[model samples]
Target: MNLPNQLTEREPIDPKLAVGSSLPNPKGLLAIVLALYLVNEEKDHLDYSDKSGNTIILKPSLITSLKAFFNGITGYNATEIDSLASANPLVEMQIEPLQVPLQLFWKIAKINILGTDSSSGERTGGVRFPKELFFTTNMDILKNVISNENGDITNTGKELIYSWLTNNNTPTSSVNIEQKLTKTLSVFSEETLFKTWNNSTEIIFQQEGIYNAFDTTNATVDIGGTKEIKGTLRNLKSSISKDIHPYLKISSSNVELKNPSLATQFDNYQKRVSNYLDLNPKSIEIKIVETEEEINVDDVTILNKIYYGAPGTGKSHKVNELLKGKEERTERVTFHPEYDYASFIGGFKPITEVDAESGKEEIKYKFVPQTFTNIYVDAWNNKDNEYYLVIEEINRGNCAEIFGDIFQLLDRNSDYSITPSNELKQYLVKELTSVDGIKGIENGKMKLPSNLNILATMNTSDQSLFPMDSAFKRRWDWEYIPINYEKSEENPSSHYQVVVSDSISFSWLEFIEKVNTIIKENPNLGMDKCIGNYFIKAKDNSITLEEFINKAIFYLWNDVFKDEDDHIFEENTFYEDFFPIATKGKEKVLKILEKIGLNTPEKED
Candidate 1:
């Protein structure tokens, strides 16, 4: 066969070839091993039935030894011939075709001494053994060596079997032979021997006939193809062993051993099988190709945006929705009054460490990275994936002091860069050196990658706490989340009702509309002082009398209408009078609602 130059050209063979009726029954490592042994013993001329119409029979002694062998390996007794025969072929046609791949594995492991070529016009012929065979003559010794008292092969027995199989031509340890055979057999069972196809019998026979052709000199000419095959087989074995390890019925009674060499072999073999059983190679490869395609697509637009609104207007919720599935790519930090450059960027912080020479615990100042530096390095390292840095309550912190020299990075379009301190320069060199598309770090200057997005949320009510200057404010695109009064599924607060009493309740949105109108009409308090739709979320869609007075009524009396000559509350009514303990406190709130045209005796539906 003239193989293609690229390994990708050799698409995986039809999956049916690995699972169809042509393959052996009870497919497993044990079944394949036993089948190979039987094929070798029978010299490819084994009969499945006698003239009396009974199946091929075994001697009682041989049957008992086989049962012991099966029990030793699987911890399960063979109560009938069918259990043993399931692994063995039942017809001459089935028996003859298995030798091609079986002998190929043996040949790969340099143990092809028991069989001779039997060419019957097939691409790969069946094995025909010599009249007297060393393996057949010493069958009892082999069985005893494999199934000793401890149900494990001793080193001495392994050496004996190795020497017998290879005739000392390969100068290697017995462990090497064990690994070679185990790996080759695993690949044979998963990749070649068990494959099936829904083709004509002639086509299936032709495909099976060529199993050994890959071992020929012509196939070896495409060295790249050979290496690719070997790599895929290794990955296949690893994937299968991992999938099957959890379900393997390993026990002290079975042939699986605790010895390091055998245990390692078993551990390696245990990692594969489950995925191979249900594998659709084409679909799996397509997913991988799709991932690569996604990486090459256009990068997401970089954002330096701020979401600002009155308290409880879902400013934070807006940012969360935009970053729903990109959690791994996002980092969030809430800015407070105490936040500064050291906390926002990288700095030398005291960390506990063990002294290498003294073997004692001590404190050391290391360049510890905060959210900004951490996400900055990650964004440059993984340029294909979008990264985010979210700052909550941005106006709560003094941005000028918190950003320091790094504030220049907010102007992403500029080619400007910042020179780090000596400690930070060394850290940046270690992290950003040799990273593609990142420049000037080695020269002690650094700039942000285009894939990094900086998002912040601000409460308009707190704008006076630490007002951001014009330079800092101009760099970010600002968005305002207005109060949503529409009583729809999207507006959770629209369904809320302030429970004034058992017989009197009013829509929370209606109360806000009335109170906001009064606040807007007052010259001292306008839109900024208007109550937000979500100023207080209701529990079970009901805001209790206590919560309503403590939160809503208190804020309106103290903050919004405290200095206004015209207000919504009754004359001489103070904030304390709205408390539950005040005389007729609930009645006073009901009267205020009636004054605002919201005291209709109706409950939420």
Candidate 2:
């Protein structure tokens, strides 16, 4: 703190002074020279130093803890230097084109593409393929193709592409994804990969030399001895997905206007047209039925490729049955009001990271395969099987938002290729995708099992309603399944079935007829809301006869007489369905029934 008047300063190493070096004289001058020397020290010396030996005089501002960085005690923001590094996008993968021996080979192994030996296996039809074709014993060569008589492997690529087929997540990412053989035995890799067969057995990719096979360009490149390539047209799974987009599904609309007297008086032409639904004034088809005269369903997968309808009517249940063991796959997803894209795809979720000390807030990336996503993935590369995705209550939420980039994927009629959603692109490179090089979904086509059929179910009665856009409307086959009232030898008794506590109960066919009459007389009341589920809850939970009436009355209060009731009759009338408890659990329903009245009959003896 002393001024130039009288003060002493210590110098760590005194530099040789010029004959007239006046800085060596006064203490203030000595401080100046020492400060300059310390500040100009080499960078390595700055890393560690003995500051206690000498005080390097610096500006008082530099001594302030926050500003000490300027003094170089803590190194300068040297990390900024990284900004000068060069960025090169070209990626390279190295393959040492080695010639390996045909150490092992097999023939005509009877196998099924479905990967099963069960009764279902018989359905795919047994195909003979080369089997146990191993590069070595530990390495099991996956048999995926057949060989023809003319010294050529079938397009199936079964002769050579060993573990890569059956073992997924291999060739992990596309980058320079080349395989190397450390212990090159009889040239098992090189011979099949480079020579002998020429283009006859393996596809000679146009890509010359080593390059990132994961790149979009190489996605179509067929590898040596591999029966299948990612992007090629011959790929069955991708093709099937391309074909089924435009099929219309119609099963849930009642075209009849229910005017019996008017029907009786109408001309034959009028009755025929009304039955066709196009002539019905209030008819709305949930799934399109290919009537005698109407637009055929679009044949594109991205065209309204999905259809969701009522529960017990067996919308999903029916679609699954249609495909049943007939198709290769049947995938299902239940869409609630809360279903989200994150649950469908991949996302960052909260997690705990523990170390030697304790846990800390961390993010764990989770790849959540949505019901549709998994189906699409499994179906994408396989050509031999049909895949189905059943979205229960497909429209309960905003499909446009929830589907993100894949909304286009559901377009059954649009062009199938497209850019992936922004979210999927942000987290990964194209190498991560299952199909060829599908960086995104575009043109309404999901890069999936070309055979994928989407069947979505939307209970027309759900409260979380949405008005489907006109464009989306035309893309589907909206079928309405109205109740079949007459039950005889041909129509046979259509009983009302219910599931209660694991046990099932059925009422007479007449019960459905009575309810059908009520719904017919009152168009505002939907059969899905008033009939099926009503009986389900009643018969399943064992509600008494009075309890059934009380529950049915509450059900009517929902949309049946929702807005019509007055406030004075609110408690007793049970309109608006209580707003909250229309979709309540058993507990809330018990409470509502207790307060108002009972569905149970009086127990007077």
lDDT of 2 at 105: 11
User: Whole-model lDDT for model 2 versus the true structure?
Assistant: 0.33
- The lDDT values for all models are 0.54, 0.33
Q: Model 2, range 433-543, lDDT digits (tens) per residue?
A: 544324224332335334566666666667357556765656566656443445543333243332111332323244444444555455555455544422334343344
What does candidate 1's lDDT look like per residue over 1-605, in tens digits?
99767755543222221110222221232232443354344242322222112223333444554454334322233554334432233222222223333332221111121243221111111222211112232223333434449755544434423333222322244445444434444444443322112231111121122222233232211111211122122222332332222212222211122334454444444444434444623232211122111211111232698988777777776677556545656799999999999999879989999999999999999999889888888767655345689999999999999999889878976788889888877777787643553563746788877668898998877889998889998888887878777887657788898877777778999889888888778777677787887788789999988888888888888887888778878989987776553336787787788778875675334
**lDDT score at residue 526, model 1, on the 0-100 scale:** 73
> What TM-score does structure 1 among the candidates reach?
0.50
Tell me each candidate's TM-score. 0.50, 0.40
Give per-residue lDDT, candidate 2, residue 231.
22
Off by over 4 Å in 1: 1-302, 437-442, 581-583, 602-605
List candidate 2 stretches off by more than 4 Å: 1-312, 326-328, 350-369, 426-449, 488-508, 523-530, 533-553, 562-605
All predictions: root-mean-square deviation over Cα?
22.4, 31.8
